[model samples]
Target: MSNASFWKGVLPAITTPFHADGSVDHAFLAKHAVQLVDAGSTAIVPLGSLGEAATLSFDEKVAIVATLVKAVGDRVPVVPGIAALSTEEAVKLAQAVKAAGAGGLMVLPVYVYTSDWHEAAAHARAVLGATDLPCILYNNPVAYRTDILPAQIAQLAGEFANLQAVKESSGEIRRFAAIKELLGDRLVLLVGMDDAIVEGLAMGAEGWIAGLVNAYPVESVQLFELARDGGYAASAELYNWFLPLLRLDTVPKFVQLIKLVQAKVGLGSETVRAPRLVVEGAERADALAIIDHAIATKKA
Candidate 1:
């Protein structure tokens, strides 16, 4: 399928669900993908930052994509994030997931190493050219120290036909307008940060690579539709109540926080992989306050 307009709605940057044994939970994984799509998510983005991509092994990541593909049934795109410490590994996974039935790919900066545009370009170029699958460039300067500026995004967009979108997660609303000013719809611009969704949309972002969506897919989509159709003022009340919980997606411990919310709503468990533990102590208490409050007073 073509990548045009692929970034049109809330594409969940889903959290990885782990079993009590710490194995990937394929059963819940499949069920969750279909549920999100049915709730109005435009696509399924697995093995992303929100999915705890760093902790996953290569084979585990591929299997997750395969499970999501089988679950979604080609109804919506399954765009797995292609990220590895090495360009070769990233390219290898990109091809594997493409064969596994991924509709598209989201290219991320190489793990753990920050680099200049020259280095970043080479890595992105390798992955973008790896497969002809439509690609979305994942730009989160905060998480991955490498920042692909708007002009650099234009550079890649100009060179790669498959690189059709940019997930702008710089946490600055101006980046959205900047990308639009330079690319002018050449690349579908999407907000990668949850707290900035409204501002990003106000600045011409067509979609959101949403984190909070995994817990509240219905509300996330409803909010997106409301804001998209009726503007910010119309969506303020709901967005206001949702804001406290949405901020959880911006923190470093976001994966655990989002998973906790998912667990609270009975959508999934709060388990996470090693190198990262589930939120505990005071963090869990504070997070639950927000999660429970939102659930208590939620609106469509």
Candidate 2:
């Protein structure tokens, strides 16, 4: 796939829908996948951080990706997250995503033991070198704490043909400008921060890999469109309205909060795997209030 074709506009790192008993809810997952695509998402990302990919087994992740691929049926690209602790496991997951007929793979950095720039570059090359499908380098130093510098990214782009895009979540506005300058349109830079979408677009970001889109696809897509059309005033307005919920994702309990918001909107179940707890009492009520306020203030 070309750099422009993989993941443009609002591609939600979709959350996995689980059953009341905590099993993968394939039926509801498929339904929500269709709804997201139909609601104006340019692509669907399954088994991502927001999807709780860490807790799912290999078989479960494969099944979820296959189900999403089947549910979307080529209406939009399904990019499954290939997040693993090792380069070998990341390669295995990438191959599985490709074999499942997904359009591409979102490869995250190895999180267990952080590496320096050279090691990180080799790791990225090894993972992408394992698959023929297009790959999006997820530059989330906030979560991984290891930055993929502009020079390192340029080197990777020079080395791998399939490494065509990046999801910049470093929370540094200067980094976006630096990427645009260094890459010079050689790569597609998608903003991974919801609040930075408009600013990133103005700085030449191609699209967004939004997490809140799971709850508000319409608004997310609208923000993208407005940014694409240079309507920063309008885009900023919508973005500001969703800022409360977007800010909530920065919390350690964001994964649970996202699922809870999904449940509140009747989109998916709030069930999450163990080692992660569901929000309760004051926190839970506060999250729901944010969601409600977002819904009420949504543009027509």
Best by TM-score: 1
**Whole-model Cα lDDT per candidate?**
0.90, 0.83
Measured against the true structure, the TM-scores of the candidates, in listed sequence, are 0.98, 0.96
Model 2 pairs whose backbones collide: none
- Candidate 2 achieves a global lDDT of 0.83
Superposed on all Cα atoms, model 2 deviates from the true structure by an RMSD in Å of: 1.4
lDDT of 1 at 34: 86
Candidate 2 per-residue lDDT, tens place, 244-266, comes to 98877666788898887787778
Cα lDDT of model 1 by residue, 1-300, tens digit: 455567799999988899999999999999999889999898999999989999999999999999999999479889999999999999999999999999899999999989999999999999988899999999999999988899999999999988888999888778888888888978888888888888888888888999989989998998898888888998999899999989999998999899999999999999988788888899888988898888889863
Candidate 1 has its poorest 10 consecutive residues by lDDT at 1-10
Per-prediction CA RMSD (Å) = 1.1, 1.4
